[model samples]
Target chain A: MLLKVKNLNAGYGFLNVLWDVSLNIGKGEFVALIGPNGAGKSTVMKSISGLLPPKSGTITFDGQVINNQDCAVNCRSGLSYISEELNLFTGMTILENLEMGAQMLEDKNKARENLDFVFELFPRLEERISQYAGTLSGGERKMLAIARGLMSNPTMVLVDEPSLGLAPQVTDEVFNALRLLNRQGLTILLVEQNVTKTLKFSSRAYILEKGKVVLEGPSSELITNDHVRKIYLGT
Target chain B: MNNSRSIKAVEWLKSSGGITVTCTILVALAVSIHKGPYVLVNTLVTGGMWALMAIGVSLLFGVMNISNFAHGEYFMIGSLTAYYIMHPLKEYLLETPNSFLAFITPVLGIAGATLAGVIAGILTDKLIFAQLRKRNREGWLLNCFLITIGLSIILINLHMLIFGNTFKGVVNYWDVPSLALGDVYVSVDRVVVFFIAMLAILFFWYLMMYTTLGKKIRAVAQDENGARMVGIPVNRVYSTTFALACGFAALAGGSLLFMFPSYPTVGIAPLYNSWFIIILVGFGNVAGAVPGGFMIALFQVVTRTYMGEGWENVIPMFLISAILIFKPYGIFETKVRSVWEQ
Candidate 1:
């Protein structure tokens, strides 16, 4: 297993969000956690990424117990988490923003290589390299955020709500990019609301409701499960 | 491509870089023509010192969101540090003007002053600001202001108790003759101070522009949580930033020691002047503070020289108030982020 969460319970101040949420992701697997609004999906991602401290239980990544490690440390250790809001530095140029993502690396040549790879993955970013990030369109901004995550060259990527507030076509573009990355042997844990599309792309799926994992199985089996179809799939 | 290309020119003009250059050149021209070559040179020297202090003030304010009311106290501490350092070396420096000791003594004094300021700054962050931040309660903005104001009071009284209420000076240059450039009588020591200030400013500029630390500082300033998410140590950055800002303040204090009186309340004037420069440059823009300092210093020099000595203090206040009323976004067009959501 590349990442494991056992009996995890976490939340914000005075409001518990995740409860006994045990999950696992194998190396190079694309796993999706799908749920409705306020179902505590984001809280799970936050807890795993060390953005929020888990109330109890352990988050093990690459055989190391990393329950309360700082978010930056988690990032440096090759567990990249992309928040839903896509927090790119608006005042900086695209190149500068990418450089910030590659900031932890000691080798300048490696940083340059990462930069070239990001540019290759997202050519639009290269075209607008000199332009300030604030001016980029929604699709481009999302792409830049994902591209920045790749600059760190993580072992696994945890993305929260990649399709939120985007047009359908832009949504497809983002997922396709993630799918492409997963195919290239990067492990991914995705928390998303778009169930049908996510299930189609993911190798496995977990259905979260009210902070608990109600169902978990292969995407092919979950797609046919009656409870998933009735509640999440809106069949 | 064409649209982005066109917008790039507009962005450049609208950016802080455009205003800084334009303001500097325009002020240089006006001072030279109206105040003559001598006054222009004098203004540049003094303005350079004020600019250094303002850069520190604005950097802290921009990054940490603290007005740092004790900034003046840091300046006071800096000047006093230099005074005490020079006190023991005064007799030696006076007798050995052309000797290596003479040259090294002032350098030693400057370094001592800077180190003192940096220590004070680090302690302030660790003892006060860091505590406030750790508590992480609501209304931190107001809390920072009130705490810094209180710290300023404590520092002022502490300095009085330790150093007493006497004005001190480096006695080596008390009777030394000044070099003359036409009608302007430029003090040799002040000239050395000016060159050192310029070099310090350039060094700061380079650090912010091309360094990884600078990038981290900018990241933390833009978004603390985001920076942490990306693995930058936000707390350490805050402490370093405070130290750097106060270190620059000390540099200004050290440079101005040869020309200005060193007293317990000596920092008040520079502090007030830095506030004016920061405001005129606009908040949240560190680079703009440099040219902004130059603008205010020129105003003071010209007003005091041409109008009257009384007008020196009064003019800056009036000018800053008018600018605030009319163009509160500042001369560089920095956005007022608090007024409306983006």
Candidate 2:
């Protein structure tokens, strides 16, 4: 297994958001967690990314318990998290944003190689590398955020709401990029609102309602699963 | 053809930073032709030292969101530290004066002053600011200013009690020979002070631009939570930035002792001067503060030379009001942001 979470209970301040949530991802698998707005999907991603402390649970990655580790340390340990905020340093240029991801690396050559790899993945980013990130289109910003994550050369990536507030055409580009990365053997745990599109790309899917996992199965089965159909696909 | 050319010139002047630079150059040229090159050098040296203090203000406000109103007191303390150190050293050197010992005494005294400033900064952070940091209240900048205003008062009085009400003579540090060049004669001490200020400013610029620590400071300044997410210890950066600001202020104070007298309220005039510089350059714009300081210094020196010595006190206030009324972000607003945008 690349990543595992057991009975995760987490929240902000006194408000508990996640309860008894268990999930696991095998190496190189693409998994999706789908739900409506305010379904605690983002919170689960936050907890796994170590941005939020779990009230009760164990988050193990690569056989080490990484519950409540610092976000950067977790990132350095190969768990790249791209938050819903698309948290690129907006004031910085695109190249600087990518360089910041690999800032902790000692070998400049390694960082340069990673930068080249990211540029290969998102050539649009390379084309406009000198422009400030704030000026990028919504789709390009998402691509840049994912490319920044790749700069760290993470083993697994947890992405939240990649398609939020994007045009249908642009959303396809972002997801297609993720699919390409996944096919190259990077494990992915994605939290998204577009259940049908996410299911099409994911190997396995978990349907979350409110704070609980209502259903879980392979994506092929979940697409036809009656509960997922009624609650999500609107069929 | 001339009308179109003049319109283009007007457009260029109306653009960001163009008017400010043009105005500064005009003033500098007017001063040079009127007051001679010696006074120009003198004004630059004075401005350089003031710029160092302004840079401290900019850094503290930029990274920590705290405007260190008691910054001048740190400078005053540095001067006082130098005064206390030099008094004993002067007396000992007078008895069996060695040229090397005489040279080393002021150097050591300045070091002591810098150390004292850093220590005071650490204490201020641990005792007063750190508690407020934990509370993390809104209007914390206002809270910091209020507390620092009170701190400024307490520090002024404490200095009076400790060092006495009388102005302590700072003769040993600055009593160096003057160098004559053509019609202009410049003091070696002023030249040394200017070089030191430039070096210090360059060091800070290098630190913020190239180093990991500089990146961390900028990250914290941009977004504290974001910095923390990147594994930077935000609180530690805050404390270090504060200390560095204080150290810069102390260094300025130590350098000023060579030219000025040290008193309990010695920092009062410079405090107000720093406020003007902060306003002139905009708070948190460290790169602009140096040029802002020189502009103000030139304005003061020129006005004092032609108009009267009294205009030195009145001109900065007038300029501040004019700037606030028109360009409230200061002349170097765009430039400051661009310098760190990498």
Candidate 3:
């Protein structure tokens, strides 16, 4: 497996959000973690990405146990995380933002190749290279955020809700891009609220509630689960 | 980043800042034209340092949310550094006014002062603020305010104990004569200081706009999580931000060493003046501080000319009070949305 988590318990301050949540994903696989609001889905992503230290449990990535390592170290180790905040330098231009994403590259020359790849993924970024990130439309901002994550050229990308506040068409564009990326042999761990769409793209899915994982299986099987369709799917 | 569109607040410049600016310019022009160019030149000279100090304050409040009560201490450190360097060699520098040695001496002192400020900043941030950051910083704003106040007091007392409150400053780093503008003449030092401030602001702007380091700083300022997500070290950026702000303050102090002498209590006024600019420009409006500094300078110069010496301070206070009563947000208002956004 490219990534594995066992008995993960984490949260902010006294309120422990994730409780014994465990999941795993092999290389080149697309996996989804879907749950209701405050289901600790994002919390699990944060622990794995090293933004939040797990209260207890081990997060093994690429055969290495990265428990106390920070986000910067994880990023350098080829683990890219696109947070819900997007964190685009609002005062900076798109090009400058891209350069920041590629700042960890040991060789400056490779940054150009990464830039080309991200620009190809989101061409509107090229057209508006000089414009400030603050002015980008919502859909374009999501694309830029994802594109920025890709600029790191990570072994695995943990994306938290790329579709949030985005239209259906833009969400499809982002999902299709992720599917294409998974096919190209990059591991993806996505935390999204949209269940049906997530199950459609990802090979496997995990259902989380409150602070624990309730169900975990292949997306093909989970999509047909009665419990999922009744509550999450609102059918 | 949620882009929920809301009604933009009425900018102070379109109204109050506009009035203050237009009135200051009109009054300054008429007064200076009638009384000679002394007022205009003095405004320019004094305005330069004020602008630099204000920019530092703006960066602190906007980027780091550090209400630095000891900002002036950094300036004092710079001035002290410059005084130490220039005082002993004052004679040699005055003798060879245009020599390379003369030029480099002041530059070296200013550079040293900036280094001193950075060192002091690291001590305060890494040793103190970083620890506070590690804990529950829910009341961080109030905590930082008190901590900086305590820092200001400690530094002041420490300087008094060591340096004995004696005013120490150089006559001049160079022997260049004053420049005549119409009926009045202004010293070469003021012009140099003004240009230095402009250049520093320009350099800072370029660094922030183009460099990856700049992006990291801005990213940390906007959102720590965002910066972390992108692999930018947030804690390191915090320390760097504090250091940069202190360095800027120290540079201002060093450059204006001829005017502001080294004293234990020297930083207090500059700190207040910096806050004045921050208030006039809206707290954290980095770009607005430039003009706001000059506006404050003009008010001071004009008030001192017409009213007297101490009343210059009173005018700004009264004006700020009046402005606040009407447009409390200042010129370019920025609402604090999150812990990082402050």
Candidate 4:
């Protein structure tokens, strides 16, 4: 498995967000965690990505236990978390933001290669290369955030709520980009609120409700599951 | 051509009115008090140092979001170091008795002072700020303030115990004849100190505005987590930024020591003045610190020269309080939300 979480229990200041939340992602697999608002999906991503410390249980990525590591270490270990909230340095230009993401790479050549790949992946970024991230629209900022995450050339990308606040068409564009990235052999764990769409795209899905995983199966099977349909899809 | 000239004349007239009013007030006060130009010059030079110290404090707090109560200690360390290097601490330990070393002492003093300041900054970050950061403490600003205050007290008392409370003077490098330019008499020492201060500010401005390191510091200041996520070494940047702030404090301390006598308690006046200057300059804006410092210095000088010694205390207090009440960000307003937007 590229990433594994077993009985993870975590929270903020005594408020537990993830209780016994277990999930796994194999190498080069596109997995989605689809659930309602405040379902602890993002909390799971935070714990796995090392943004929030896990109170109990273990998170192993590529055979190495990474639960105690810092966010920077996790990122260096080839796991990038593109948070739902806009995380771009607003004062910096698009190029500077990309350069910041590639800071750990000592070689300029490798940074340039990543820069070129990100720019190619999102051409709109190239056009607004000199513009500050703050000036970019929500959709552009989201694209910039993803492009920044890709700059490190991580083994797995954990994206949280990429579709949030975006128009339906823009959401489709972002999902398509994720799918294209998955095809390029990068493992992706997507935490999303767009339940039906997320389920349709992923090979496997975990339905989270109130901090615990209620249902887990192949995406095709979960799509037709009665409980998931009633609670998530609003059938 | 005639119309354009008229427009230009109107714009110039409108802008010059504020300057004229200020100049008129200064003249009236100067005439009424009838103080010597020497005292006025002294106040101006001392005020400049205060402003410089304030700039450092504001930069650390406004940009880095670290309170750094230990900032005053850095200034004190710089002043004491400069004094010892220039004068040679014969009372403390064995003296080298090298005449050449004595001649180059001021430069060595400044260098030593800067080094001490840098060391203090690094130690604070490693021992306190870094630990707080790991625990996910958001009240680092308050903690930093407290830590720095404690450090200042400890350093001051230690200096008193080690160096004693006696005042010490640095050997003036430029003790040449004074220049008489019209009614204003400028001392070579003051001129050199003033020029050096200006150069240091210019150097800092250039570094912050143009360099890659400056860009990274500003990026981290904007959003530390965001910067970290992008692989920027946030802790490293924080330390470097703190070091830079201490370096500035050291420069100001060295310059102040050169102009005046130093005591263990000398840092108190500068620290007090810096508080006003920090508020006078828009928080986190280094460029504003220069003008803010100069303006406050100018005000202090003119007030002391024209009104009396009492106005020296009253003017800065009133001006700073008024400015804070009206524009808490200082004379220049920076986009505060931009710092948190990331």
Best by DockQ: 1
CA shift of B132, model 4, Å:
3.3
* Candidate 4, position A69, lDDT: 82
Question: Is model 1 an incorrect, acceptable, medium or high docking prediction?
Answer: medium
**Which residue segments of model 1 deviate by more than 4 Å?**
B1-38, B95-98, B171-177, B306-311, B337-342
Candidate 1 clashing pairs?
Answer: A72-B231
Docking class of 2: acceptable
Per-residue lDDT tens digits of candidate 2, residues B1-342? 999999988986886566786888887887688768866886888898788889888888777777778989988988888788887888888898888888888787778888888888888887888899767356776898899999999999998887789887566464557778786778877787888889988999999877877877877776554554444566777778878888888888888787766788888877778889988877788788888888878877888787898889698899899987887887656333421242
Instruction: Give the TM-score (0 to 1) of chain B in model 2.
Output: 0.91
lDDT of each: 0.83, 0.83, 0.84, 0.78
- Where is model 3 more than 4 Å wrong at Cα? B1-19, B91-104, B334-342
lDDT of 2 by residue, A44-113 (tens): 9989988787999899999999996878788878888888887777767788778777776779999999
Return the TM-score for candidate 3, rounded to 2 decimals. Answer: 0.92
For model 4, the stretches where C-alpha displacement exceeds 4 angstroms are B1-51, B89-103, B136-139, B178-185, B335-342
Show the lowest summed lDDT stretch of 10 residues, model 1 chain B. B333-342
TM accuracy, model 2: 0.87
Tens digit of per-residue lDDT, candidate 4, span A52-150? 889999999999999978788888889998998857888889998888788777788999999998888889999999999999999999999999999
